[model samples]
Every structure is written in C-alpha cells, then in structure tokens.
Target: MWQDFGDYILSEAGDDPVKIAEIGVGKFDKISEILSEKKNITVLKTDIHPKDSTVIKDDVTNPNLELYKDVDIIYSIRPPSELQPHLINLAEKINSQLIIKPLTNEDLNTGRVKMKLKNYKKASFYILR
Candidate 1:
C-alpha cells in the first residue's frame, strides 16, 4: 500500500516539494525511511500515542489544521472510519491528494467525502486532486 501510495502521489503531484501528513505511524520507522528516498518530500508522522519526536499529535477526525495547513498529501493506514472525511477535507483544503489503506472488508463509502477513486478495493482506496 505504501508503494501504491508513493505511485499515486508521484502520478498526481510529481517530484515537487510535498508536505505529507501520515497518521498511525506508531513505532514504524520504516515508513519514514522508505519515503525518505524521495528527496523533495517532507513527512510529518503522527499517532494517538506519539513519542516525543512525533509531530502534530492530534486526532485525525479533527486535525489541527493550523499546524498542518498546506500539506500536499494525507496518508493513513486503516484509520477509524469517522476520520475518513477529515482526511478528505484536509486534502481538499490544501488541494492535495489522499491515500488510504483500509483493513480487509472495510467499507469505503461513508458518503461524507466526495472522491473519485483512481483504484479501490476492500483493502485500499486511492484518490487524487
């Protein structure tokens, strides 16, 4: 899904300096490490229970946009269903893109976020501006 996410972002925004906000980073350093391969990207990793180095420790359903304005991409791996619309709203606000990897069998239609999926499955939902 991360690879798919990288492809989606590149296809939409290319190699520009992208501001990426990722939720549920938890203790996985690999995400940041892999994304670091992209030289022009800035990653802000977040979680409900963040360590000291985590940035923007806020809930995804109501993100602190004042701290996260102008982001170029919003990424999440199976965030709570209620937070999905907020992700879409943030992307729309910043004119960015959204990449979400949902758990198997999870539904993508909440009807709150209006999006046209480039590709979608029970396991993933990929969107672009």
Candidate 2:
C-alpha cells in the first residue's frame, strides 16, 4: 500500500513542489518519516486533538483550509468511514488529489459519487478526482 501510494504521488505531482496534508495521523509517524525523505515535499500532519506531536489540530470534516490553501495531495490511511465524504469534498475544493485507505468499517460504495477502483494484492485503492 505504501509503495503504490508513493508511486501515485510521484506520478501525480512529479514536476511540481508538492504539499501533502495528512489527516487523522494518530501514531503513524512512519508516513512523515517516509515522505520527508523525498525532495520538494512538505508533509503537514493534523489530528482533532492538538498535541505537541501533531503539527495541525483540526477536524477533517470541516477543516480550516486557510492554513493549507496550497496543499497538493490529501492522504489519509484508515480514516474514519464517516469522514470519507469530507475528504472527497475537500479534494474537489482544493483541486487536489485524495488518497484514502479506508478502515474495515468504512464503506467506499457511495452511489452519489463515481470513483474508479484499482485493486491491489493487499489494499484496494481508489482515485477520486
């Protein structure tokens, strides 16, 4: 899943310097560690509860995009199922690409929105534009 997501990030925002905003980043510091290794990529971490560890504290559903106006990609791994719609909405608002690896409880099957699914060995991915 990580490799596939990295590939997608490279292909989607290869030429431009990109800002990647990760919502619901609980204990997953590995993501920041990985993205930080790449050049021209700034990863801003956010969560609902503000802590010294969290870079930004805001809810994904109604986020304050003012601080993240130029974000290029919004990445969420196992975000709450109810907040998936918020991700889709924010992606459209910012003209940014959304990468969501939903949890077991989240259902990606929302008939209102049309999304193309790419199934992988371990994780099934979707690209919502």
Candidate 3:
C-alpha cells in the first residue's frame, strides 16, 4: 500500500521536477524517503512537533505559506480528523494537489469541499485538486 501511494505521487510528477510536501509527518518517513530518492521530486516533511531536524516545524491549521510556495503536491498520511479541513484549506490556498490518506473508514471533515476517494493498487486515499 505504501508503495502504491508513492507510485501515485510519482505518476503525478511524471518526469517533471516537482516540489512535494508531506504534512503532519510525525514519525513516519517511509513515503517521504521514497519520494526523496526520485530525482524529479523534492519532498518536504512538516509537523507541528517535529521529532527531528529533517521534519520542519509547522502547524497545519496555520501553515506557513512560504514553505508551500510553488509546491506541486501536498499529501498527509493518517492526519487527525480535525486537521483535515485545514490541510484542504492550505492546498487550496497554494493551488497544489492535495492527497489525504486517512484512517480506514474515517470520514473526512472537509465541510463543503468534496474530495474524491481513490484506490490506487492497495492504497486508498482522498484527492482534491
């Protein structure tokens, strides 16, 4: 499933040099690690309580717009329900594609914005563009 998620992002990148950001990246780095290895993709990991120097400190509710400037894609893996809407807001503000991999069967709290549910191989997630 993880590989599927990474592949989906890679497909979206499509050989283009694209900037991607991972929000609420607490302790998980697998997807970021995979994306970082690709020559065409630049990955940024952010968390409100960064566990290490590699994870930048940024609150999703009030994200630093500068950090997301020119970012082509923004994805969050299992972000808390309360923060999902904020993620959508940030993505819209930055005009970047948004992907949210929420917990299994967890309903999104996106309000009026409807995100499409996607199943890419074994990975299941929601996408908003």
Candidate 4:
C-alpha cells in the first residue's frame, strides 16, 4: 500500500522537481524516503513530535506556512481523524494537492469541499484537488 501511495505521488509529480510535505510522518519515514529518491521530488517530513533529525517539528492544526510555502503536494499516512481538517486547511492555504491515506476501512472525518476518494494501484486514499 505504501508503494502504491508512492507511485501515485510520483505520477502526480511527473519528471519535474516538486516539493511535497508528509504531515504527521512520525517515525515512519519510508514513504518520504522513497519519494525523495525519485530525483525530482523533495520530500519534507513533519510531525508534532520529532522522532529523528530528519523529521521537522510542526503542529498540523496550525502549520507553519513559512515552512510549507508553495509546496506542490501535501500527504498524510493514517493521520488522526481530528487532524484531517488541518491538513485540508493547509493544502487550501497553500493551494496544493492534498492526499490522505487513512487506515483501512477508516472513514475520513474531514468535511472539506472537493475531496474525492481515489484508488490508485490498490491504494485507497482521499484527494483534495
């Protein structure tokens, strides 16, 4: 499923260099690392609690716009139900595409307009364009 998510990001990013943020990345940086290896993608991993030097410390509820200025894509892996709106808000404020990969069978709790459920390569996720 993570590979499916990564492939979706790569496809959305194309061959052009793009900035992408992974919200609430926590200790699992596999997807971010994979995306960063694409050579055209710059992945920024963020979390409220930094587990390593690579994870930036930031609160999704009130994200630091300065850190996410002009990002192309914002994605979260199994983000908490309560923080879905915050991710949506940040994506809207930055005018970036938002992708959320919630746990299997877990319904999205966000009520943001224009959110669409997408099944990319067996990866079931929500996208806000």
Q: Give the TM-score of candidate 3.
A: 0.98
Q: By summed lDDT, which 10 consecutive residues of candidate 2 come out lowest? A: 102-111
Off by over 4 Å in 4: 112-114
Task: Say which prediction, candidate 1 or candidate 3, comes out ahead on TM-score.
Answer: 3
lDDT of 4 at 109: 80
Cα lDDT tens digits for candidate 4, 14-110: 9987999999988888888889888888888889999988899999998889999869999999999999888888998999999999999998888
Query: Using Cα atoms with residue i matched to residue i, what is each candidate's TM-score against the true structure?
Result: 0.75, 0.82, 0.98, 0.95
For model 1, residues 1-129, the per-residue Cα lDDT tens digits are 656555555555467787777877766545565676787887888777786675558776676777577777777777677777777776777777677766666777446565555562222464645
Q: What is the C-alpha lDDT of each candidate?
A: 0.67, 0.74, 0.94, 0.89
| Candidate 3 residue lDDT tens string, 1-129 | 999999998888888899999999989899999899889898999999999999999998888999999999999999998999899899999999999999999999999999999999999999998
Q: Summarize candidate 2's per-residue lDDT along 1-129 as a digit string, tens digits.
A: 666556665566675688988888887766666777778888888889755655688887798888678998888888776778888887888888788777654568434776667565455667776
Candidate 3 regions exceeding 4 Å error are none
Off by over 4 Å in 2: 104-106, 109-111, 120-123
What are the clash counts of all predictions, listed in order?
A: 0, 0, 0, 0
